[model samples]
Target chain A: MTTGFGLNNLPYGVFSTPGTAPRVGVRFGDQVLDLAAALNDPVFASPSLNPFMAQGRARWTEVRARIPAALENGPLHPLTGVHLHMPFEVADYVDFYASEEHATNLGRMFRPDSAPLLPNWKHLPVGYHGRAGTVVPSGTGIVRPSGQRKPPNQRTPDHGPSRRLDVEVEVGFVVGSPSPLGQPIPTSAFADHVFGVCLVNDWSARDIQAWEYVPLGPFLGKSFATSISPWIVPLDALTEARVPTPPQDPAPLPYLTDAEPWGLDLSLTLSLNGHALSHPPYASMYWSPAQMLAHMTVNGASVRTGDLYASGTVSGPDASQRGSFIELTWGGENPLKLHDGSTRTFLEDGDEVTITATAPGTNGEAISFGEVKGRILPIQ
Target chain B: MTTGFGLNNLPYGVFSTPGTAPRVGVRFGDQVLDLAAALNDPVFASPSLNPFMAQGRARWTEVRARIPAALENGPLHPLTGVHLHMPFEVADYVDFYASEEHATNLGRMFRPDSAPLLPNWKHLPVGYHGRAGTVVPSGTGIVRPSGQRKPPNQRTPDHGPSRRLDVEVEVGFVVGSPSPLGQPIPTSAFADHVFGVCLVNDWSARDIQAWEYVPLGPFLGKSFATSISPWIVPLDALTEARVPTPPQDPAPLPYLTDAEPWGLDLSLTLSLNGHALSHPPYASMYWSPAQMLAHMTVNGASVRTGDLYASGTVSGPDASQRGSFIELTWGGENPLKLHDGSTRTFLEDGDEVTITATAPGTNGEAISFGEVKGRILPIQ
Candidate 1:
């Protein structure tokens, strides 16, 4: 169990003791090593990880390497005694539809009459900017979002709490380094810029999305509250998890192509009220993270430190590997049976959803990506 | 001419002299009154207007009232020698299709066989989030964005500079005060939350937009650069411009309705290379700014101090009042004759697009929203 948080998987996060202010810390098994106290540095004193995240890749690597040695002789605090917060301030949040299986499933379910995949889906990675202010840390209770929803039978929209709420199990990439405007970062340069990865539960209102998503993309449908894991597993720790992406039939453009494989073989598990629901394989994504980053910046949009972009619902080829409740329950037509003898179509008030993942470490052990858990609360 | 920047329009901005640090300033006739020096306070000393904007409506009103009296004896700097910067840090950038003409024209042009408006357009203010980090201030040169674009004849998308580049003349409302995440702000509270307004040039890549905007909305196509005016004209100054919004045909939901008129009667002019192209009437917008704000936050998205939401292309009923080149030239089918004897369907490399607007003042004078201008530079 201690090997799950081995030396190779020293993830950074912000934590605070009962009476102390928030400070940077690194997880070591069930304890947290206080990096600020260990180094006696003011750089890690900030409540958020933004100040340290802005130091770029060189500093991030240096600090990560130094953390293991510091923990051997430095102060340690029990994880139970400290409260973990949102690791870093999200500069901009972008959600990308990268999973071919998930996109195809959604298209087939939503638009049964038309072709499952859109014309441009094979050519480019489809993505949209999401609300950054509402991105909450793991364990934050998500309030049932109330908004305009148009049922299939109704001609007009009605104002009420969302009936079809869903969660997308995603792997979020945080940008540690900044790129200048009017410059495009190539697919090969992804490792030089991206900081780390974390699990994200992109809470969505399917009813609002169905009604409002027309000329524009998702807005209020997904902006209410997006929960992200507290621990950010650095890219350096996932060296063994790198796998090859699925082959493209038409082949991508030169800008979106990379000679090396960039996919990660992380196994993710989604649970509802302590019962395991489905397993979403991260390696099965059609579009690689590097390709997404390359396509995002190809048009000269600058990258800022703490900028977060998530791989849209990670689902594999099989039905058991579906990442979202919408897919598992087939848009509420099918209800999933849990271990507790309860059936769920969508998350109900007071029901808790937890997503956990693990990847193979260099030493043939499992490296966990802590948990991104959230309980849904009724409309206040 | 001087009445345009008279006592009625004291737009706030960030400016700096040759050797001084950036500070908040207000534009008077041909000079800038240093607000920090005028008030002798540290709150106005920040580089951006975010600090001042976060002070809320009461403080905003107090500062506006004292500016004129303090300017008579306060420190002044010549506008020629001062460098103006982004007035406020953009928290999030949302573009809304509030103009019926713009939406209908786009609908007809893009989907010739379909209805002029989408089914949900009448019931809701259609909007999507744009890249916030790439939002630049006025006078910033917009680099011709290069990306994957598919021509009508091409089977695959070709990676290159955008062939069809255009500008959307829009009015941006800046949120000064913020409401709770789960609570909806009513249209009646618009004055209490919105600090001011500015002009925005939503630079667009029509070809890229057409290709990528299907399942999801516009991404890289409209993300490269969005230029906003340096000065932010306070809403208090535009009291006389408040007019009744155009009649909503189907009638809005109760949450979207406003007891008082919230539309502004501002006249906007779009000029290319000094040749006037169109005059989009802001008062003709089908959905008011207040309604847009209400719809945006109704789904529980929290408003930040510097959040910017723009009224999408303010095209009126007639072709002469179009807001974008796409509408004026009818998607490159017809070219416009310029003063230099040049025919242009879309923006050229050296083309300079300037958007200026003036709203009715309380005492019959004109209140100007200082121009937002940008020159197009070829892809670097």
Candidate 2:
């Protein structure tokens, strides 16, 4: 819908600005737009703007609401475009298991008849703590794991480079403001901690995850590599794209229920190794982000900024639209044929997969969370 | 029994020597004994000492096994005369909610009939993400939190000082070397992540926790302030203190079942800042650290060095043995009458509290975790 240059699409990213004070910048086309310079000018200046006027590098949470209320809402919002770099400085990161589709799918495979959902799943947002120190921005090559794998003939797990590194398409959102000790933020305040959203491709080692997940959740299966896009789309901009909640079987508790339509109508697709023919649409999800956010706050736990709540393996109703080939083929019974004649239920090394999503809108311009890409490398 | 200053009375703490590097120290009377230096000298060492030395400070997991060997063989260990500090540098820290007595006691008032424990309760350890950034050493003062709070009778929360600051009596174990990713650490490998145990008093802001917990689990409610003693008591030292796990209604998964009696018969108690009266027996709890550890690995979660999982409250059947004033008073219903005639459930400004836990050894000398103390100051 946008006829002019899409300056409004200038998503901000955290970056180490050279020489100048630590601050923020907006990405327009291929260049970064600096936000600090405008703060000193008459057009943009205030307390919120002060977070962007740092000395070296600042986190998104530090200057989240500061882009001048007027700039965010008025005519100058789209007019200002100063060149700058990416705008992220992540301190800690956490991933949450929110989608019922992803949860149920994984659960069904574990316990078909009884996997309605582990009883505690409905009560709280069950999260296994992840490694924050290892979280890296997008384009970082994911490595295939050489771990204990079980072959049918062996008693002990075969130790070698895993041939089953897989990709999971997910959305990562940033936390803005920190909550108080012992206080749980209500649904209304979920956005307060949400700085923005980014594209996420959670790389997995399916073989490793299955073998190790008996007493704990994923370890090396997850630690191998998880990728996320560099750009951050603020929550304020996605107001128009929010969707209704999917169907639910068991009624959620007071904490999980909400009035707002929480899911995003994101047109999501994935391309394996740059083969344009492999991409598919993303839908058929039953849970919404609001439900996940609401469920998370029930424990009175405070979520930090830069924390990412992943939907796990997001898939559609059928084979082609299915997110992961694991569920798409029901674990390897039916293999998926790649464009280059490689048939697989999972990924192999040196393979690159890209996932991109865009929210639908009839407004001036439709906002999109760009592609999340990762290439697998053989582990020594 | 230990009649005089004897072998059984040794305590542990983190200390730094005037000329040597910082490392784990064993406490004897008022003087400090260094373990690393003694391990290097044969006059102060033994064959049992070789195992401890083999692990080097970089891999202190062997400390747990070596402690018992050193204790059993009787006094040839190098660390005896050699002065040591608290322990090695904590590489990472992860806290857990392991005690049902503590969980139920705390959950009873808030959740009434149905608690949050899932089917995995009897089998696996339930835990959440913890902050390693604030896992400070002993003698750190806990600051009263200044955060947004819902004032009494107000629908909207106001930014104010935390009113219900409390302390939790906890036990923390350190991991030695890192576990390979995606690998399930067998019970035999349990020693890998453990350097030793310490008395930890997890400070909590009950009022703030009550208000903010929802979508995310405890964040600021805990991260703002946490305190722990400096010693790393080898896991072997408490073998004599082993007890049986209490019975549960439902059976747990096989992974959660203990291979041996896992509970420790240590006498644990809390003081009002350090003044105390008689409390219940320490063997009154229903779970063990081993069960918690095994439960953590049940789902294939890999643990790293410096992770500190805790036994939530460590309360007994009686109110007197309660780990926290919050559990002792049921949130704030039971106010504590201090030695100075002060009565309240929460900590007051300048209020000091100390907690000490010990395992009575075969000899009269008690193997102790020593004291973890902190004073609460008004929010700055």
Candidate 3:
């Protein structure tokens, strides 16, 4: 009876015990094996995984393979006693609108008169740069952001706390090895450069976004806070989870076309308070993570070791499988009824949202990808 | 007579002589003064200004006041043999469309039927995040970015080198002091948090931008390479250059309203090859830097020590004072004749652009903001 932490899955994280500085640790059945003390490697002594991740693919493979034997003889601490931090120092964060369902849902609500999907949506993956400084670790309290929000009927905008605060369930890819300034990382080089995968909750203020996202993408609406799961599930751990993505129409350019399927067969669940609201299947995603990376760098934009890019809002075709409240509730026109007989159009104060995921492990076992949890607090 | 690098305006940078690692230095009259050797402080021994900048305003003030005496006794190296690196590691790079003239010009050309300025333009400082990893130091060659670009007449998009490469002459503000998460930095705290200003040339690919920038803001269109001058002119040195900005038609929000006017009166010159083109006046900008900083953080987004935010293309009322080539050429409808009697709609291969600025110093002397220069190279 493996609790999803068998030898097949060893996610990396930064943890600290009482009076001890934060350092690298590997998760094993309810316990964290300190990598620095177990392997006696100084690379794991740093707070961030950047130093070790920068050692490239070969080093990551060696360390991942070595962790199992080291766990047999090393001292371990229970997960409850350790405080986990941001696994890596984020370099640059780019969010891609790769979910066909989510993009179509948003386009229908935002632009009712026009076509559901934009002209360029099918041809290329649309992505934009996001605030890297505001990316916090999971369990960090989300402060309700205050900004300018104007409804359609309102003549002028009002400045106050955002009324429609929501969460976007996403899968974030982190870069380990960096590419040169003018070099484009091809789709074939995705696994070579991408270190691992983690869950992300891209908190958004819908009202602020609608009013301001015309010429510019998103600013204050999304920049306030973004939370990520503490543990990083290495790409090497998910070999059994590889699946084919939903077929793309009008095949992408040669630069973005991947010869092999790069989709992960992970299942994601979103919970509000303690009730499970939706399960957005990652297999239903339109674009693969490899294609997103290729499209991002095809223009010769370099990526750093800690660079993070997220698959924007994982949503399925069904209404119950929507990833964001905006899509699930149909842009606040329909309210979702909670398990406690309460209704929600969007998140309110003290609303806790947690997103968790799991994928197929070796020998028909399951591997957990940890969880990203956050509680909303009223404006300070 | 001082050549802009006077006693009153000693800007900070990082430079390295042959066989020596890069370290902190100050520009003083065509020579680089080593701060680590002069002050005998380890903070000045860092390769980037982030360490010293993180020490906050009081330390920065003390160091600025002590530089004159240190210059009198310290050994100086002529600037010719020194190679200047990126002064600081950019945390999050943001570009704000604060220029009324520039925004209106783009709006008029892009959306011909609608109102020039968006309804929300006057209410807030519209900005978006840019790739920090690709922000290169001045003199770095910019490779022509190739991406998916669909011209208006074409049925489908074509993937190739961008035909409409351009440059945006702007001023960049570097943040020295970081604000805590969820704590909004008021307009009055701008000078306390912002360390200095420098010249920035935000390279752009106009053709790719036109197709992809529908729902989302600019991405690869502007992410290839952003060039910044090596030297950072401290905010304290620009005291004499303060002026009143143009009046706002509608009063701004209380958070954006500054008690003291923070408008800078710097004169900027843009050159192509060796011909002087336009002179963009920073004083003509609609939004002040303080307001931009205040607006950016009002939503509880935290700022880091090395965050950089730029005033978008600083175009004045007249056509001759336009900052970006898109506006100067009216979106390629008009061509600008150079000194060689050659007309250009957009930047061609091997075209070099240099942007320089100057502000009033003490005793009627001029202080330089240095120059950000870059040459375009054909795609590899």
Candidate 4:
């Protein structure tokens, strides 16, 4: 389990037979391997999830419910690289802020003038419902968004494609048991409501957002192209990795505090241009994962599985420790001194932001959220 | 306009004649009239919007592009009473919290020890994309939600109906344009994105939220039932009421601050259990309307007319000015002492919550949001 070799990591996705057709299957090693073929022989596939069956609509979901312990020793371990698939899909996706450290840093950045700590902030987990249609699997090419961009000290307004692009590194969690509208789940039952975790890369445009956010918050700075890692690491596998507790002060409003201590000590890294300078561990956040999840449902907004919540630019204010350019350089005023004598206030065209994270004992083969590599394809 | 005739105050809905089916329109004065019946007339309608047949769609969007001065003697004056319906059929609804002040207050209530804002929160406006299906017109019944409510100091949770039921007094801004994905609107173009304003009551369940929000945010506290007033006050009518701009502390991120001063001073009130009480005006905000809209579209999120952006509970410290029970009583630990000698920690069944706002003018008829009221039904 420590090695993350548990069968619970069988990340399944809905796909098509190559042509605009909708199909479903599990992703293994380096291929959209067929789950149906491997199950041709009952004896070879009966142990865990069968091929044609694994590719079946409800297989991943049904298999996701069983404790990770049951599927750990299943016979399918030998069929690691086989091809299989079927038809299953998600109807909706609701992302929750499940990490405490991520939420803590986020709140501090936006609520600097206030207590930065909210009454409900500690008492409840929070999240926003995102567009599922754009919830593409990993490796999808992000389209360069064309929107209004304003520069500092400009008297006459200017418009153009988004030049100030940014990225958010996040671990995506999926729901297994559907939460009934109005039915509240407790902290102990968070696992029951969750199915697995994935990686998400929420792409953003910086320059366009500066002028508009006043009385109301953002309207377009976010909803654009969002990327997610392919694999779905189940909740059962993560239960063992849950940490001691959160460090929120003033205590919570009673409702937000949980019984069992929980936090994941996953190591995360973000590299720009290359894998050299940006990769950092995920442990620096002030809050915990359980706390973020708790805040999301605290509002009683019904949540569904397959939801992708991006921990928005997880960063601590320090060199070699900042998550994105926004924090590393404080919105470009303080340019990041780069290796080759070039200062980076923001990403250049050829820069690719790559994010990776892994639990200890997993060797260096980190469970990564592929990459959101887009050359600032020159504006048309 | 020195009054609070906000873009988020358009209160429109879809209703019908006792003898007919449901259609769309707004409740003006004493008349229950038809916009289609009015906009089609040469004196009332704009020629640019003729492309819409006035049935399926074509809200005030086209005409929304025209400046307010162009319509001084327009047809809106005589549509009183005529039996109004929801202004236009809403194709989509998006809500945002552009007022960083309110968002900041919430952050403080939760995390007392550290920063509560996210790094990306400054680069882009933070928001929770709301559910479109529940975007109902006024006069809708609010069903009391049932779920687990954990109290402070409890080791085990209690499963039952929600006890800490509350209402969020807010303003709803409606969009008038349909922005394509990845296409952002500049600050100057923010008005083109807005069509009007209305009042909204976001219902919340504090109990279920506390226990479940850990790994994710709210699922049951909200999304139960959100109420909106039924009459959209076009953006044209409220511009004259704009007052001095909002004051910002810690200065907003460059992308958020503006040199131009802007905001409305609309007189607003909350009638508890059908009785009126004084609430803070929309003027107490830290950010302005244009700033909020600018932040939203900056990230490339699509903006469609009829979208609703509800400013989080518009509250002040005084109980007479609290926007929600959460703040009025500070999470039930401190209950509000009401005028009727009744103390309110949360809304009770049969208790009606109405949020009304209007921009005062020389004529004194004041452009108002009318009434957004709902009686809590026992959760079955």
**C-alpha displacement of A248 in model 4, angstroms?**
8.8
**Residue A29 error, candidate 1, Å:** 0.6
lDDT by residue (tens digit), candidate 4, A321-353: 556666666556688777778877776666666
Please compute the TM-score of chain B alone for each predicted structure, in the order given.
Answer: 0.99, 0.83, 0.99, 0.79
By DockQ, the best candidate is 3
Q: Score residue B55 of candidate 4 by CA lDDT.
A: 20
TM-score (all chains, Cα) for each model: 0.99, 0.58, 0.99, 0.58
For DockQ, candidate 1 versus 3, the one ahead is 3
Docking class of 4: incorrect
Q: How accurate is candidate 2 locally (lDDT)?
A: 0.57
True A-B contacts kept by model 3 = 0.87
Taking the tens digit of each residue's C-alpha lDDT, what string does model 2 give over B1-380? Answer: 22211355454554554554445445544455554454444422321222342353544443433544454433232433443332444333455666677766766776677754433444345555555545556666566765445645875554456777878887777665555433545554555455567777778877655554442356546656667775556665666777886775455444555677767777776777567832534566565666666655533445555556666667776667778878777778867777888787778888787877778565555676766777876654
Candidate 2 segments whose C-alpha is farther than 4 A from its true place = A1-92, A96-129, A133-380, B1-6, B9-12, B17-24, B35-92, B113-119, B148-153, B277-282, B362-364
lDDT of 4 by residue, B1-380 (tens): 32333332333444455564544443434433344344454422321121232321234544444323323333342333234444454433455554454556556666667675544444444455555434555666676776556687775455556888988887877776667655555566656667667788878787775655442244456666677776666665665567755555445555555535457667678888767765857777555667776666554556554456766567654557767777666667787677789888888887878888877543444666677888887765
Lowest summed lDDT across 10 adjacent residues in model 1 chain B is found at: B1-10
lDDT of 1 at B92: 84
Q: How well is candidate 2 docked (DockQ)?
A: 0.08
